[model samples]
Target: MRVSPINAACCVLLVALLGAASGAQATSIYRTTDAQGNVVFTDNPERGGEEVELNPLTVVPSGQRAPAPQSRPEASASPSSPSQAVSSPFMPYSTFRIAAPRNEETLQTGEAGNLQVELGIEPALREDHRVRLLVDGAVSQSAMHSDVFMLGNLERGERVLQAELLDASGEVRHRSAPVTLYVQRASVNLPQNPNNPN
Candidate 1:
């Protein structure tokens, strides 16, 4: 059988194209339409061909697994204040004492036996501490955050007043110097007793 020249030329062209593709890297690709309006892609730039832009390629190894997700550290659960800690290295307040109702002060209010006691603390009181009032070595009022204490119905005689500073855990941290208070209540049987309807 005689070899056709057209077929031989086609085969040679195909081999040449394959050789060019393998020998050089395809850095850019150009797209254009042929005479028959068919789309054609080639590495050679044509007169009216459009250059296609390519993004970076991502590669994954065959048998290698992705890095495990890192774990986030948990936030601290304890409080940030230093005063609340029982093992604080130093005291927060330098001056803690009772400011009002001076020692040996005589109180004669018409309200029978009511007195307002004030506390003096250097700087300021922290949220983790509390104050308690003591009368005659006994707790007259429970612990609270206020700096004032109202004593009601105090016995008509000499009374001892003291203020105690408590920590967050209800532990005594400091105590003011005891104060002596003298109460003068009018006797009911006396002529000046207002409650008597004479």
Candidate 2:
């Protein structure tokens, strides 16, 4: 029952998000352990885990995030609510967004979910700022000082990604427009799959 830091962090992120997004009825969040021994959280009870009841969670529109075509962000940042990430009066960035994994790119069924993401931030990110990746609306991991993110373990399916810049205070200084990526895995039912009996 060992949990990696990344999984632990993901658990925390899910809890934080569920708490912030819950309402009067309170959406239910289920915690489960994946085959890899990684802790996973989801809304599906069928996935199976203890039900966690918490306050309503509001989805953080950590978007308005993105970058220019060739530019990139500077480095190092952390998490805070979108409320805390209000547009600053010092909005100096002209462009920012995910540059790699081009929108609609597809990963072959044989490939693992490893993703190498690049940011296009104009004027270079400010020295006082840090950048983070948002996968499907949730912060992928803590902000860092580099423009490049080597991300792995992406689930098989459609994934939306964005990059956000944070001020020293941890506000959402800037976010890149989201890029969509699909990770395909061989399905037994697929006609092209050798395992397909049909």
Off by over 4 Å in 1: 1-90, 195-198
Q: How does model 1 fare in lDDT? A: 0.73
Model 2 TM-score (2 dp): 0.49
Local distance difference test, each candidate:
0.73, 0.77
* Total clashes in model 2, counting residue pairs 3 or more apart in sequence or in different chains: 30
Count the clashes in each prediction: 0, 30
Off by over 4 Å in 2: 1-90, 186-198
> In angstroms, how far off is 144's CA in candidate 2?
0.3
